[model samples]
Target: MTTLYLLGSAAPPVLEIASVIEGAQKRGYDVCLGLTPSAARWLEPQLTDLEQLTGHPVRSEYKAPTGADVWPRADVALFAPATFNSLNSWALGLTSSFVVGFAAEAIGKGIPLVTMPCVNAAYAQHRALDRSIAELRGMGVSVLYGPDGFEPNQPGERRPEGYPWHLALDAVARRTA
Candidate 1:
């Protein structure tokens, strides 16, 4: 089976993550979810449901060093709802969280990574963000943003309903193709 490491960050779109997972599964991918701490907390109420759907636990924190691997190695990974902070941090090689750590290493491991950012226009305009996106793309990370992917909204606007979860799955499918 094609195993996907689906990483979710603390963004409004994290609310629709289940749909993304189901979409990927329907496309013949087995998924393992790795959420940033805040994202995990945001999805707390549905963790059990998510686990049942994926047949594995949703991991936010790192397991004990002695613990065995919880999920199979990823064939591909998608970082959905990739936040401004996570984007910049991952680009800069920051591995403070399990999600970011795995993302950073996935690149070196030759694992295809697709990032679907959910930042607002203001955040997307930050000088660092463009550089980060460029850097990740330069490293072969498929970043879905702008006109062809996700179009950012103005700051303070919440468009959780408008988040393109299907786009993330499509990006992964294209990359894996």
Candidate 2:
């Protein structure tokens, strides 16, 4: 089975992550779930259920060097609903979060990577956002943004179902095929 690292940030779309995992599984992926720290907190109650669903532990923090690897090597990775902070941090090569760190290293390791941000129009106006997206693309990471991928809504508008998860999954399928 294709191993997929499905990482996420603390965006509203992350609340429905279980369905996203099921979507990946239905597409024949062996999924491993990872989240940003705040995302983990947001989904704390569902963590165990998510672990059971993926058959892998949900990791938000780095593992101890002494521990053995729990997840399989990823053939592809999808970092969806990546918040503004995480996206910018990733492009800047700051990997304080586990998800961003793994993605940063994945570039050097040649793992196929895709990302879709879930920022509002207000936050998307930041000058760094465009630069960050460009940086990720320069590293061969397929960034799904703007009109086709994830169009930012107004500040308070929530559209979890509108997140184009299929786009993320499909991009990985193409990359790893």
Candidate 3:
């Protein structure tokens, strides 16, 4: 089975991450969950359920190198609700978190990647946002944002009920093909 490293950040859409996993499973991916620190805290209550659903432990931090890897090698990496902090940090190759660490290595390893940012209009307008997107795209990461992708929401407003979660999976499928 194809393995997808499903990395998530602290964005609101992380609250509905089950849907993203389900969507990827339907596309024939064996999904493994990697959460940013804040996302792990937010998802604390659902960890067991998520583990059962994915048939693997949700990893929020790096494991010691003494043991064999718990999860299979990722065929692709899909990052959803990629936050501003994570995005910029990732672009700058900061591996402070497991998700970013994995992403940084994945890029260097030439593993296919897709990212969907969930930033609001104001945050999206930051200068670093554009540079990060450009840098990642230049390095072959398929970033799903802008007019054809996710539109920025207004500040203080809840995320739209219609966030396009499947776009990430579709982009992965296309890249891996």
Per-residue lDDT for 68-133 in model 2, tens only? 889999999999989999999999999999999999999999999999899999998899999999
lDDT (CA) per prediction: 0.92, 0.93, 0.91
- For all the candidates, what are their Cα RMSDs to the real structure? 1.3, 1.1, 1.1
Error of 2 at 62 (Å): 0.3
Of 1 and 2, the candidate ahead on TM-score is: 2
Runs in model 2 lying further than 4 Å from the true structure: 159-161
lDDT of 1 by residue, 55-84 (tens): 998999999999989899899999988999
The true-structure Cα RMSD of candidate 3 reads 1.1
Residue 102, model 2: Cα distance from true site in angstroms: 0.4
Per-model TM-score, in order, reads 0.96, 0.97, 0.96
Residue range with the least summed lDDT across 10 consecutive positions in model 3:
159-168
lDDT of 3 by residue, 45-75 (tens): 9999999999999999998889678999999
Clashing pairs in 1: none
